[model samples]
Target: MGTLSPAAPPTTPERTKSRLLEAVKDCDCATAQALADKLGVTVPAIRRHLQDLQDAGQLEVRTEKPGGRGRPQHVYVLTEAGEATFPKAYATLCVDVLDQVERLFGDGAVLRVMDARRLEFQGVLASRLAGHSDLGRKLTALAAVLCEYGYAARAYQENGQWYLTQRNCPAPAVAKAFPQLCQAELTLYRDLLELPVSREARLSCGAAECRYKVG
Candidate 1:
């Protein structure tokens, strides 16, 4: 006799509702029509799902007026509750550990940890960047590693300059508490690239992205 296969997990009342929630997660904010178009569903059906999620505290709605529009559009954003449904790696935990280390030891101890992390990051980058003779190729490999660690990173060339930009910061909490993290990363890139990698902006500094360029 053949053995029984494992059963599939139970789903919510409407699978489309889950998709709608994910849509908001992806865009960070979306309108009913946009979600409908993305999921290939009717507007009315999408509204129902958005309403249900809002009622259940899974989303928040905001009103936005288009530059040229007859009616203000309703935008949906995932609430803390909705965000909880997705997979996450809490960088706050890293902040907590750093706090404990600072408490037990001192600021000097935390700085040392930052230095150690700089070495570790350098090692990882060096391994992947091996044999990448072109500067663009090296930055592309570095971008891949950063994305794997949750920083949404991209490498590109513009105006005859090569740049690495990170749109998302994986460890905001840690970076906020320990400015050393930023400094250490800066030092690491300089050492590894053997060139001056100037930082044009920083996400932690409220800029749109953390940008580094070879000049």
Candidate 2:
């Protein structure tokens, strides 16, 4: 008699939750109905997974007022904790290149490279933010540029002070390895905003996200 073959592994709620998270990652936010349509699942199933993510502090819900609506729709976005679960290669590649450069020359070579990057970023940001005199608008434009570079940045104000919060870091590993990168980013913000910008929290220093206070 031949031995029986092993059964295939069944998909669990965890896998479903992962898929939901991935879908949310690709978009700014998603609704259960939208996610159901995208994933070919029922609304109830999508809600279940979303609830699980929320319970685990991985997702946030926002209500949107529909234009011709009867009721508001709930939109889900990945929290910083959730965004951290995604894959990031920029940090690893950056560290590898810096290591190679250091081995080829010296520690000073790494500083030069970082300074060069700072100058390039400054030029680009200056160009993008030109002709914007309003502090609020400048910060918004800066946030948009940062988002384009995978920072997931947003700008807001409280107590008459402007702030920028970045939910995701494209180079967490690199920033953790090289503090200069973080300083350079701070400098970039200060220069571009033409305001005194202080880093309130840093992902590299074990914070959930990086936040900057701009005046």
Candidate 3:
């Protein structure tokens, strides 16, 4: 008798797991039930995949008790290791180039380059925020511009002061190496809004998000 062929390898589950990971990536946290609903899979299936991912150190879980709920719900978020698996090229290349620049030119030369970048962004911000006189309006416009550049920025008022919050920093690795970039961002906001700006939190400093307080 002829040799029997092996069955085809299963891939749909793997694809579903990837999709689940991506969905969690887009949110602060996600529950397994929500993930199942979004992915059109059974809760047991979602739990199985989540367990696998957790075992692999790619996911972390937290239990939340919605008040008056029957049971606490499990929420999942990607660990730093998991986030690292996503595509990111800007930071690595930027740091490499900056390292080369420092080796070739000097520390002062790197500072000068950063300063030039700050000045260039100042002009661009001013133009983008033009015609918005009210601080709140200007902040809103500024947030839009930042979001366009991949900052995932939003502006809102709290405690009688306006704030701009960036949920994600597109250049985290670069910022970690060159803190001047963070300073430049604060300076740019101050110059553009024509108001005093203070950095309340910084992503590079391990804050969950980057927050700027504006007045």
Clashes of each: 0, 0, 0
Stretches off by above 4 angstroms in model 3 are 1-9, 13-88
Candidate 3 lDDT by residue in tens digits, 1-215: 99999998776877877888898887654898788888788899889999999998999998876554768888899998788778878779999998899899987777778889988988888888788988888889988988899889999998898999998998898999988788778877787777888998999999999999888
- Per-residue error (Å), model 1, residue 211: 0.6
How does residue 70 of candidate 2 score in lDDT? 61
Residue range with the least summed lDDT across 10 consecutive positions in model 2: 64-73
The better candidate by TM-score, 1 or 2, is 2
Candidates in order have lDDT scores of: 0.86, 0.87, 0.86
Candidate 2 per-residue lDDT, tens place, 1-215, comes to 99999999987888888888999987554988888888889998888888989999999999976665668889899899998888767667879998899899987887788888888989998899898899888889988998999999999999898899998988788888888788888887787777789999999899988999988
**Runs in model 2 lying further than 4 Å from the true structure:** 1-6, 10-90
- TM-score, every prediction: 0.58, 0.59, 0.61
TM-score, cand. 3 vs. native: 0.61
Report how far residue 105 has shifted in candidate 3, in Å: 2.1
Q: Rank the candidates by lDDT, best first.
A: 2, 1, 3
Using lDDT as the measure, name the better of candidate 1 and candidate 2.
2
Predicted model with the maximum lDDT: 2
